[model samples]
Target: MIIRNLADRNKKGADTEVVDGQQRLTTIYEFTQGGFSINDELSKRIVRDNSDSYEFDIANNAGKETEAIKFYKKFKKGQKVSLTYGTLSSLMKADFDSYNMALTYISHHDDNVIAEYFRFVQNQERLRAGEIINSIPDSLLEQYLMQVDSKSLLFKLSWEDKRKEFDKLFYAAIGIFDEKLPLGGVDSDIIEYVKNSAGIAGRALERTNLLITQLQALSKDETWNFSSGINKRFVKFLCMLCGYGYVDFSKNPKEKLQQLFVVNKKLSAFSSAKATALSNEFVGYTEEQIENYRLIALISKGSQKWDMVEERMRLLAVLMNEVKI
Candidate 1:
C-alpha cells in the first residue's frame, strides 16, 4: 500500500512510492478477496473492523498514522507482527557500499530478478545523482539501462537453465568494459573521454549482440544441446577479453564472431577431470588456483558437471596474459 504525505504532495499527487513487496501486497489483496486457499486465522483477520474508532491522517503529525501501522491494522489477526518501513527516496540516496552489500546478501536468498532490480535502481540513482566516481560515462550507462528497460531482442535469447542468463550477459559486459574506462581524473574529463571513446563501447556491444544472436539461433536448433556452464563461461570469457583491451576496437563483428565460434567449439570438449588436473598442476599457486576453482564452484550445482568452467577460465587467464604459459 502506498501513502502520500499531504504536506509533501504536489499538484500531481504523492511523493512516496513503494519500491519493493509489490507482489506480496497483490497476494494479500487477492487472499482478502477470498480468491486463494486461506486458514481461519486469515479469514477472521481480513474482515473490516467497525468497532475501532481510529482515523488515518497523512498531513497532521498529531494523529498521523504510519503507513505500516495502517497497513498492519487491516490484517491484525491477533498475532505478533512486525513491519519494517523505508522510504524510496531515502533508499535512492543510500550509500553505495550499503546498497551493494544489501544486494549481495539479497542475492543469496531472493530470486535473481530482485537483485537485478536493486542493481538497476542503484546504477540509475548513481547516474541521476551525478556519482560518476568510476570510468563508465553517464551516456553509455544510460544506453545499457535503456536496453534493460526495453527488453530488446538481445535479451530474449534463451539458455539451457532457468537462471537469468540474459541479465548476466549485460552485467558481465558492464563489469568488463567499465574497468577499461580511464579513471583517476576529474569526473568531467573522464566523462568527456568516455563520450568520445565510442569505439571501445561499440566493440563490446558488437561482441555481446553477436553472442546473443548466436545463442538464440543455437537454442532454436533442436539438435544442439550445449550445457549451461559452457554458455556462462563463454560469456564471462568474452567480458574478460573486452575488459582487458584484448579486442581491437576497430575489428569487425564478423571477425570477432568467428573467433567466438572457435572458442565455443573448443570449450564444448571441456570436462571436470581436465579441470581437476589443471587445478592440481597449479597446486603451489594456492590463491590463483583457489580463485579458478571458485569460478567453477559457482556453476557446480544441479546434476550437470560445471567444474570444467575452471579450465575454461584458466584458458582465459592465459589468453589475457595473466599466466606466462
Candidate 2:
C-alpha cells in the first residue's frame, strides 16, 4: 500500500514516480471491480446475471467478461476467485474484517528520493526499511553499500532478493565497527557513513570478498555457499576484523575460516521457521541451541536494542576464537 505523490512534479530532472506492491494492489482493486469469485456457496449467494436484482449498469452490459462469467470459469477449475454484489444490502450480508490502509508518502523531486524509495519498496518485508537508507542521497558510503549488495561476491552468496537482507548485515557490520548501533537499525550516524565513510566500509567489503573467494577455492564443492545466519554473522565478523586490521587475510586465512565454518556445514533449514510462533527452527539444532536465539523481540519491535546484536556478534567472535578481535 504505497505510492508517490507526483502532483508537483512538472519539473524535468525527477520524473520517475515511485509505486510499490503493484501485484498486490492490482488483485485487491480487481476484486472491488467484481473481477473474481470466492466459492461455490458464495457464488450461489451472489446476484444472478439474469436476475432483475442485478443493478449496476455494467451488469446490463452482457458479454464482455463479467464477474459472473469469471465465476463460472473458476468454478470449472475447482478454485474460487472471490465475489461481487449487485447492491449494498448484499455486500453488508458478508462477514469481513475492516482494515485501514496506511500509506507512506514520498513527494521529493530529487533522484535520491526516487532511488531511496525504490530501495525501501524493494526491501519491504515490509520493504520499508531496506529503502529508507537508500533514499539518503548519494553518499560515497551509500554508493559503496549498494555496490557491495549488487557486486561483492561475498554478499551475493546470500542472494538477497531486493529485500535488503544484505544491507541489514552490512549495517550491523558497520555498527559493530563503530560500536554505535542505534535503537532502529540505521540512524543519522549510520546514514552519514553511508554517505561518506571515506571508503572504509568499501575496503572492508572488498577484503571480505577476497577471503570468501579463497575459501571457495579451498572447497571441493563448486557450489559451496557461505550464506547462513551463522555464516553471515561470521562474514560480518571478518569485516569487523578487516576494518580494524585485526585479522590478516594475507597468510593462509582459509584454514581459520574453515575452522569457523566447517567445510561440510549443511546450512539448509528443515523448515521455514514460522516467524509468528517465536521460532528459530532449523535442522539438527538442540533445544538449547534454538533457545539461544536472542533479541527476537527486537526483531518484531521496531526500535532494536543494539546491545543484544552486539552480544550476538561477540559470541560469534568467541566461537571463531578470534581473541585478536
What local distance difference test score does each model get?
0.37, 0.43
lDDT of 1 by residue, 146-195 (tens): 43322322332234232334444444344334444221122233334445
Instruction: Evaluate model 1: give its lDDT.
Output: 0.37
**Clash statistics: count for each candidate:** 0, 13
> What lDDT tens digits, residue by residue, belong to model 2 across residues 223-320?
33445544443454454444444344445554455544531122112111222222323345454543333222122123345455445444443434
TM-score, candidate number 2: 0.36
State the TM-score for model 1. Answer: 0.26
Native-referenced Cα lDDT, model 2: 0.43
Identify the leading candidate in terms of lDDT.
2
State how far residue 25 of model 1 sits from its true place (Å).
33
Lowest lDDT 10-mer window, candidate 2? 263-272
Q: List runs of model 2 lying over 4 Å from the truth.
A: 1-107, 110-136, 140-172, 183-290, 294-307, 319-325
Relative to the true structure, candidate 2 has a C-alpha RMSD (angstroms) of: 16.2
The deviation in Å at residue 19 for candidate 1 is 25
